[model samples]
Target: MTTHLRPTDLRYLRLVRASAWYDLVVTAGFATPWTYALLHDALSALGRAWGLGTLPPLDPIQTLYANLMGSVVVVWAVLRLARPLPLHGLLDGTARALFTGWQAYALTQGAPRFLWLFLAVEATFAVLQLAPWYSPFRRPAVRE
Candidate 1:
């Protein structure tokens, strides 16, 4: 498979893996209660440090949802990191775009200013992953 791949394909694969690594690093803490506790503490401390007040502690259900999101994203990231292809980039881009939309909506509903950071990162990855398709000089991606 490597022998048949072009240079552009290699670059695309690298991009996909990079995105996956980002996901893993950003979301891995959400996957378990202990990690989420640490993450929540750190975030709250950061919020206080930034002069933004902390919110109420997360309830069990909310924690469950966070855990679910973290677990799923981490697993998906691992899969892409281990076996990235152009298709993975396209799909991950689509997912990130959706995430960006939802995250924006959450902000509009007054979730938190902290979410802006995540939203920005998601939007960046979404564009990077999807932009090749819209480039005028884009080559057709090799089929998986």
Candidate 2:
């Protein structure tokens, strides 16, 4: 079946793909590394404060979590690039939910300094993802 997308839809798709790439680069360059370091430092500090002789090395589990999350984000980005309008809504919703979760976790953790950076990234992604759905930029569906 042939498919078509309106200009608005096409714009949104490009924005979504760009946003996802932005996320991947930013996370790999800053977010993930800084977070890993911060968590490692925090855990080590906690151990020191508790008078433990030696702190364990950074938790592999935590590193795995970050890697998995990053992988998922990359996958999402690739999907957006490959299948733009067809799955736009789903990706947008997913990004929103993930951002909301990050926000909640950040707040619960008393707003760690790094979280603000993460929030900024997440917010950008959310805005780009949701732009097409907004009243001013909504796109009409295609017909066969």
Report the lDDT tens digits of candidate 2 across residue range 38-83.
7557655755576543234656776777666766766666666677
Off by over 4 Å in 1: 1-8, 135-137, 140-144
* Local accuracy by lDDT, each model: 0.84, 0.60
lDDT of 1 by residue, 59-92 (tens): 8987899899999999999999889988888899
Candidate 2 residue-pair clash tally? 0
Clashes of each: 0, 0
Candidate 1 TM-score, C-alpha based = 0.86
Clashing pairs in 1: none
lDDT score of residue 137 within candidate 2: 60
